[model samples]
Target chain A: MRIVAALLRRDLAQMFGSGQRGATLLPVLFFIAVAMLYPFAVGPNPELLARTGGGVIWVAALLAAILPLDRLLARDIERGYFDQLYLRGIAEEVVVAVRLLAHWLSFGPPLMLATLPAAALLGLDSETLRTVELGLLAGTPGLAAIGLIIAALTIGMRGGAALAGLLLIPLAVPLLVFGAGALATGGSGGIALTAAISLLLVAITPFAGGAAIRAAREG
Target chain B: MEPARITATDLACRRGDRLLFRGLSFDLNGGEALQIVGPNGTGKSSLLRILAGLLQPFAGKVERNGEVALLDERLPLDSDLPLGQAFAFWNRIDGAGYRAEELRPLGLERLADVPVRYLSTGQRKRAAVLQSNARRAGVWLLDEPLNGLDVEAAAQFQARVGGYIADGGIAVIASHQPFDVQGLTKLHLGDYAP
Candidate 1:
């Protein structure tokens, strides 16, 4: 338990603490920027913007999650943190789980918060904004989980960054479909299904991510 | 705190399609030190990893008793954080009380505020040694432990390894450079190459 806490603390510090990667706060900025760009790309059609804004937010959030993938676990594996931790008898499953949590904490809430300005940018009505925020709250955990699993699987390979990003979009389709679908239908059911998919991903990420790491170690 | 033993029998390691080393075997109990010596690519590092249980040996089995600590090329400390802060992370995981007496001897007291990435090679190597010593494991597996050390640091490392084995610990080192540990037992990895 103490090891878990230590691992979690270090992970949180690394993801959100300071220095180049942490201080960039890139995901949230990218989220807001993506939101900001779509309106201009489609011209100031408030009606059209409002209609597509929620889906745009979901796509933006998904893409933003991808931005942090390269730094997520590759460098740590390359640096031999995993082997050291394995010596300490901390399970990779636990480490990956904590990492998933840390990854979400690093960007999930910030992306949701950034959405407020984004919602305003796209002229989303208050009700739609509420739905979009809730959708993100439920969906980002799944996004972070997928990002971590892919990060672990792609570490050390040539052009891994490209493969990781490409891998994420397809794996994240469930979250995207249900999360953005909630906006289209404006239904609680969509949100619940999104939450359900998020739970499944959360449950499996530790094992899947752990196995990928162990496999990477062997190869 | 107890007698520690790590034994490997007929270990074979294959990287990709080629076999690196085959039919390698060794045993180390408490108070013994084994140094793996070979030229580059003869699998000194792989043997260390195999002993440390970080790699899957293509063949053979290993049995270990007591905790293991490995100090390889990688410095587990966070590179972006100040040295004090980085060590603090490990200290916390290690149940917080780092023996200041052990650390001061390494001559790193003045580097507490430096970011780990900014540390020179010798400094990083010294930090790895300090961290491993802090672990107080029964078995220690080190790869290229002397690569970046200055003469003084190398002497300090010899002292540390000597003290560890004197305290009934086990040390397995993989390096081509001559390591001057007391009662050293050497394994030339090339002997097992296929």
Candidate 2:
């Protein structure tokens, strides 16, 4: 627990202290604006908007979650900070967990906040909006976790960003499908399925991240 | 006061199908300092990485009794952080206690808030050394630690190293230049084929 707190504190300090607050906020805001504008430009057709809203929101949120992951372990490995963390008596799993949590915090909340305005713009029913919001709240952490795995695997490579997306997008397919499906269907069963899938994602991320870090350290 | 803090037996490492070093054996006892010297491309850095546990050797094993601080040419500092913040990070993570006053003589105090990427090579190296020393780990594995320091800073670093040894700590330094410190044993890698 103390190790987790230390890792969280260090990562949070780096995120907020390094002038990256804008980087975190601006992209979400831009995506929200673009999402909201889509309805007006495309004629505010309720059926079309409802059908597309789920996919659009999920894609935007996924992209937003992934934007910073490219630099997650690569930056640290290049600078030797990762080596220092390993030597600090902290286990690799804990390091992955803390980083995943930090990434979720930085990238997730703003995405949720930005979604509200777009939700209104899409004329989404209250139930659907709530479903979208809930799905995002539960799902972004999974995205961040999977992103950490891809980040670690590609840390030493050129074109890491592209590789990370290629590696992670396939894994994220289930989450995207469930999240958008839940929002579009507006049924309790859909929401439940989304929640269940989100839970599974949360469970699996730590293992993936752990394996990647270990491979990185050894290789 | 304690036994050897780090031990390696018949350690061997290979990089990209090339054998860097093999059958290397050493024990770093407390209060002793050993220097690893060799020509360029002789796997000095690779040996340090293996001892630091950052890289696993293809053969043999290494055991460390306490925390080992490894320093290389790579500063590993965040480019976004100022010099002081970088030091503060080391203090925060490793519980290294450093004072701004102590760093002033090295001309680092003034650059406390300047991002490390903007600093000159010498300044960056000095800051890395200062941060590593500030940790005061039980075992120090330094690779080319003297690369970018001025003469004065180098002497001060030697003094600090001496003080650290006097306090019953151990250090293994890998460098190309000859170190003039007394009571130091040399481990020459030139005789070992890569």
Instruction: State which candidate has the highest TM-score.
Output: 1
In order, the first chain's TM-score in every candidate is 0.97, 0.88
Model 2 misplaced stretches (Cα beyond 4 Å): A1-3, B1-4, B101-107
Can you write out model 2's per-residue Cα lDDT over B130-194, one digit (the tens) per residue? 76656667888889988888888788777777777888788898998877565688998776665
Provide per-model DockQ scores. 0.77, 0.61
State candidate 2's DockQ.
Answer: 0.61
Write out fnat for all predictions, comma-separated. 0.76, 0.63
Please give fnat for model 2: 0.63
lDDT of each: 0.88, 0.77
TM-score of 1: 0.97
- Among residues 3 or more apart in sequence or in different chains, the pairs in candidate 2 whose N, CA or C atoms overlap within 3 Å are A79-B76
Q: Could you tell me the interface RMSD of model 1?
A: 1.2
